[model samples]
Target: MKTSHNFKLTAAAVMLASALLTGCNQANSSTAATKADAVVAIPVEAVLTRQGQISSSYRTTATLEARAEAEVISKATGIVQKILVEEGDKVTVGQLLAVLDNERQQYSLNKEKAELSRLSSELKRMEEMYQRQLISADVFEKLKWQFDSLQASVSLAELALKETEIRAPIDGVVARRYAKVGQLVNQHATQSLFHLVSNQQLEAVVHLPEQQLAQARVGQQAMLQFAGMTPVNAELVRISPVVDASSGTVRAVLKVANAQQQLKPGMFAQVQLQFDVKTDALLLPKRALMSTDNTQTVFVIDSEHKVSRKQVHLGYQADNTVEILSGLELGEQVVIAGQSALKDEALVNVVTVRQF
Candidate 1:
């Protein structure tokens, strides 16, 4: 009887402990289920579309050049007697650039002149003799040819003497000086006496990609920015029809009037070309853009309090806002903040929206 009672009491204690453990497990599972039903919500900002012009501008680099440039060289071989203009000197057309030793050329001119005089006197005597029937017609004709030939020689000698003095071919500033006094210049040599650039009008040479070719044309206005000078107005002067094979770019020239002569050639410059203009377009802050694998995407809040991923096509961006080309509509809510933790189809609760 005692063994029977002890067995019954031990069985009762084991059954109670098992029931307690099962109840505890059921309560824990219920608690976990309740916590899992809770929905997480994210805060975001939204924007509305409005009517305003948005410009798409492309920025490019360019170099300043003179509208007109010339390399002054000696046409005739001679020793430079004097250099009248130095580098950086402003000169006009026909101004003396350098003087060459012309003793030999001068002597040649004098000899030609004397021969021409003698030929003219002889031709006069021949004409008189022919009229008086003292000389034949053929002889007079021969003397006339001789006189004309001598006259041409005199003119050639005079031109050679004039070439001994180098002159500025254009009105410009002497940008470089290559020859000095007493230096012998060769006619066929590659060396130039001076480099002149017209500063009255400056040009900026810019390389444009194929996409920008349509927007660039002659007479279009543009803005030029240099390192030290203020922004200047420029007009498109020329454009190359062919694209460079290696670079795939087209060349464009912008003409800028340098009335003050402050702009110089070879200076670096920045060029801005404006293209499309949208009067009404949906714009979102640039910070709102989310990109993955170079594919741009954005997060939007749907009507069901769920987050959804949206792919968007963007256009010109300015003032921190990007133009939405497609995949988004006006008055749609976009996740601008707390997007890092949100996933697709996740539930959201709007805390507040940013007003812009």
Candidate 2:
């Protein structure tokens, strides 16, 4: 009877221990389930209002061109004897650029000079003889006329000799050289011996839409940017009186002083022309707005912990931000980064706040 009681007591203790362990495991599983049902935090960003400047500006691309350009061509036909200036050399007006072989021309001029001198001496002798009645007046007059004709011929020959030398007509840099030594050129030839461009001033021509023509006028300030250089000041010099019928655009020429001669012809540049300005306007990041057809909307978080889609009228956009004309007030939180994943009245947890 004592062994049976001992065995029964041991069995009861073991059963109680197993029951306690099972109840503890059930409690742990229940706690785990409760933790799993809790909502997870979603990553989001908010928009904040800040003072921003909106300058009404137009952007366009233009090509740089020299104020004056000319193609230097040969004025007379002859074989090129020498080239005085090479490419990239600075030349002034009337500076000798090239010389043609003038041996034949020089010989002709020398012969003319000799004949003119001889005729002049003969005419003087004839005039003295006629005054003294030694020869007829008609004979003396004929000699005098012959002398004058010879003198005129000599002058013409001298000018033709000078034409053998090519000279620059403008003060500029030689951009190109087309004729080489010993090459034959024709008078008034279309082939350019040198291309010269004036570097003192530069201009850029940009096209503007006809609707904006009224806003763009002469004397408007502009900013220009080119490759390998910083922004430079420019001004609206002229606007084309005629507009392109097909494109509906007008050309505007911007003049800029090139004191350093750094800007060259045919270089592309970016131009910014400001037309208007606004103050005390609500601004938001351009990315925060959504558009469909003619309806523009932005997602705003209200005080009820839900996202509300509001339609907004936009004003001027400057520096990647758009002006909020209406339908939204200052200090209202707007979703900038995650608006595509949101809907009207959707539950949201503000994870981050950022300035837009």
Candidate 3:
């Protein structure tokens, strides 16, 4: 009976051990299957890196100005007989703009002409006498001198009469009209009679930091922006040789063409001065740039769709593009979207690929 009982106990112990082993095997298989079916590829949006042109630009505030601007003043003193032009009148060069009273000037001119004619007749008679030895050489010379003086007086009087009409000195719009009909004006007047400006040729004047003088140069491209207006294209035309002592800034002038007359003088503008241009530069979308601890980083996707963190040196930045000085290559895929949750060596499925 003791033997039989020991056998039963040993049999029961073996059965329990077999059951535990089977359960352990099933658990191992399930865990293996779960591991094999785990998700690996993270969804991301990427762009192919490329070599392109990039510009290093400096942006500064500026003012739009007419290339040609002047204040017109009268050269003759007289009453403003007829104000031919009003404010905002467009006039061509030498177009009559105003007329002054010229009764006194015309009368004086006529009198001078009559005197000159008389002098010429007298000089002719005296010359004939001298040729026939009927007059003294001294008398003939004196008469000739008198005739020349009278001729000069006539010319002066004619000029005075011509000055009665005021003409536009340049092709432009009359920005302001300061004189009216019957108004007395003089050559010595301090104030101008008209303000003229040409919109055909425009300019953008910007004051930049003195230190940027070294980078500034003529012929570089510029962009002029104003509120509610399309941007105007311009080029750098002038740079101050000396810095402004009070402001510690340098004045830079950009030549602009306002053929449509859209840009006007004294309009506030925002200027982007493209000082430097780089061609065939390695470039990436700006969205791919990630900043951490003041460091710029980007994720580079390899052929296996695995992403790796890369530190890059930045150069010129234009719009939505950035120049990569180092740590990237052409044709490499850069993760621009869904980068916030990326990890090093993480697999990614590029759901969308954008052209550079």
Candidate 4:
């Protein structure tokens, strides 16, 4: 009886041992599954590749100016009698801008004319006498000389009378009026009566670095932006071949359109010159670039929700966009944000899909 009881106790102990081992195995398997489900997916923002326009650009700042300007000065010393145009008034070339006192000039011209007429009658009589041998040759020559001198005097008098009128030298608007009515003015450079500026077209002279001298060319397109205004289009019309020794810069002139006369001279502007353009090229935001070991790289997201590092070749960069020459294709997703924490083959949770 004792042997049989011992055998039963051993059988029960073996069954309990088997149950404990099976329970431990089940608990370990459950813990492993829970840990696997907890693997983190990093959040990131990405953009799909697309075709767009890009250009290689150089940037600079300059001051706006009138393409054509002139300072109208008095040609005769006289009092300002009649003013025709005021500041902000438009005038055409050769249009009368102001008139000076003409009483003295007119009187002088009339007197000279009368003298010329008198000399002409005397010279005719002297010629007749000389032809008939009734007057000496020397006397006839003296009369002819007097007639020529009187004619020259009349011409001078006429020119002086015409100088009393001030005219517009260029087609432009009066920027300023210096001489007031009844103000005495002199015929000198310092005494400018009116300042004229043509705002139908404007210009900005920008100095480019000597390194960009090779890219500067006439007819190249550029953009100009003013303070609190819409950006305007401009073109490179002239470029100075010689470089400045002091500044290491090249002089370039840009023509800007101002048909409405909204832009003025001496206004500051920001300039961006596009030397090369690539239309229908693959473009990406400049922020998407990643610099790694002296080379440029990017983080790409595959359809499996994993990120992979890629090396890209660049073409042109402008306006915060860069051209992707190689290592990417159309319709691929590139991580633009949260890429700093990304690694190859790492699982990702796309937080946002943005446009390129």
Best by lDDT: 4
Compose the digit string of candidate 4's lDDT tens values, residues 1-356. Answer: 99999999999999999999999999999999877654658888999989998888899999998989998888788899999998999999999999999889999999999999988888888899899999999999988888888899999999888989999999999999997899988777458899999999999999999999887789999999999999999999999989999999999999999988889999999999999888899988889999978799999999899989999999898867889999999989999999898789988889999975
Candidate 2, 69-166: lDDT as tens digits: 89988767899999998889989999999999888889999999999988888888888889899999888888888888998999988988998989
- Deviation from native of the Cα of residue 169 in model 1, angstroms: 1.3
What TM-score would candidate 2 get against the native? 0.68
For model 1, name the residue pairs that clash. 41-349
Candidate 1 structure lDDT: 0.84
Candidate 1 vs candidate 2: the lDDT winner is: 2
* TM-scores, one per candidate: 0.71, 0.68, 0.84, 0.88
How high is the lDDT of residue 123 in model 4?
A: 88
Model 1 Cα lDDT, one tens digit per residue, 1-356: 99999999999999999999999999999998776766454555544443356677778888888889998888888999999888899999999989999999999999999999888888888888899999899888888888888889999999999999999999999999998988998878957999999999998888889878887768777778888779998888889999998998998888989999988888888888655667787878777689998888888888897888899998877767788899888888887777787889987766767755
Model 3 regions more than 4 Å off: 1-44, 291-295, 338-343, 346-351
- Please report the candidate that would top TM-score against the real structure: 4
lDDT, residue 345, candidate 1: 91
Please report how far candidate 3 places residue 273 from its true position, in Å.
2.3
lDDT of each structure? 0.84, 0.86, 0.89, 0.91
Please give, for residues 293-353, the per-residue lDDT of candidate 3 as tens digits.
9889999999888999999999999989999999998888899999998899988889999
- Over 4 Å off, model 4: 1-40, 130-142
* Clash count, predicted structure 4: 0
